[model samples]
Target: MDVRRIGVVGLGAMGAGIAQVAIEAGFDVVGREVSDELGTAATERIGHFLTRKVEKGRLAQDARDAALGRLRTTTDVSELVDCDLVVEAIVEELQAKRALFVELERFCRRDTVLATNTSALSVTEIAAATASPERVVGMHFFNPAPLMPLVEVVRGELSSDDAVATALDVVDRLGKVAVPCHDTPGFVVNRVLIPLLNDCVRVLDEARVSPEALDAAMTNGAGWPMGPCTLLDLVGIDVHVHASEALYEKLRETRMAPPPRLVAMRNAGLLGRKSGRGFHGY
Candidate 1:
């Protein structure tokens, strides 16, 4: 398929980053938000990101301008009817995704690929909402989509080979590695990652390890680039909580249970760097 136009549903941090990266890779991008205000906010968010790259000499001003030129923001789902692919990056709720998929299928072409950016939810379940479930697949990109190299090209139970292949092609065109996996709760990365993150919180709450000490041990002893604490903060504590709860609800793994501290932190609105505070001060 000649995939030239990309539609990104939702304009949250991950959605904005995905849209920016797609535009940077020379695709015509239509980013949809629930409201015009949110559409403007998403545009400004991507603009600020591009501006930062130029200020840091990481992106050429001309390239930035050209990429921005290809980006279109919208508040209507019907505006994405012409998009070759539409990726949903909305809230982590299952009903929300299913409802959006129903609405998206109503407007988009039957062949237009619909991908979900869910971290742990069942892709098959989300795809069930669409009449053409074969076109619904998981295109799960890690946080900081611009910097993350891996894209999990998830094949749902009913997802067709062509749909998965299109997703892999899209990932390649965007200069990212694609790891195809069968649809499952959390697929692969988040299956293991969410549990570990939950344990990290448990260790802190139960073992009373200082966040600094725990982070140092993981960074030095475990050979991790960033410790759990710092990583949780960077990835956002609420995201971890959501993944934890989702995984636990799906898998019923005790280790995947959301820690009390994480719930408290999220309730307090300390959502890592974006919120100015998290496990560690940003």
Candidate 2:
């Protein structure tokens, strides 16, 4: 399939980064936000990110200009109709996503592929809402999508081989490593990642050591770039809880159970970097 135009149906950090990546890859990108205010914020954020790349000599001036030129921002969902692919990166709600999929089906062309950026939601369940389930795949890009190297090309029960091939090709075009996985709970990265972070929470709950010391042990001993608590703070406690609960409920594993510390942090409204507080205060 010819993928000349791309639609990003959200302008959050991840969505904006995906838009930037698409634009940089020479595709005409339409980034949709629910409101004009948020759209403007996203546009400025992308502009700043690209400008930084230019300043760091990572992106050429003319190339950055050309990429930005290819980007269009809109509040209308109808603008996505001509796009060859539409990636929905909106809120992580099943009902909301299903409704959007139903609405998108009405506007998207027959051959246009619809994908979700959902991190933990059941891709099969999301795909079932569309008339063409085979066309719906999970194109799960990591957070800060432009910088992240890994992109999980998830295949739902109803997803087609052609769809998976197309998604992998797109991932390659975006300069990302593509790892295809069955649409299982938490997919691959989150399945292995979140539980370990929960273990860190459990360790802290024992009060045997300070968060600072635990973080140092992991980073120094394990050679991790960032320790579990630090990473969780960066990802947000609320997001961790959501992913953890989703995985635990689906897998029925005690290891996936979110520790009490995570619940305590959430109750305290220490969401993480977004809220400026978490396991470690921002």
> Using TM-score as the measure, which candidate wins?
2
Residues 1-282 of candidate 1: C-alpha lDDT, one tens digit per residue = 779999999989899989999999999999999889998988988999999999999999999999999999998999999999999999989999999999999999878999999988899999998889999999999989988999999999999999999999999999999999998888989888888888887888678789898999889999999999899999888888888888888888788888888899999998888898886886
Off by over 4 Å in 2: none
lDDT of 2 by residue, 103-195 (tens): 888988988889999999999999999889999999999887888899998999999888888888888888899999999999999999988
Question: Which run of 10 residues does model 1 get worst, by summed lDDT?
Answer: 199-208
TM-score, candidate 2, is 0.97
List TM-score per model, in order.
0.96, 0.97
Query: How far is 31's C-alpha from truth in model 1 (Å)?
Result: 1.0
Q: Which ten residues in a row have the lowest lDDT in candidate 2?
A: 198-207
Q: How many backbone clashes does candidate 2 have?
A: 0
lDDT of 2 at 241: 92
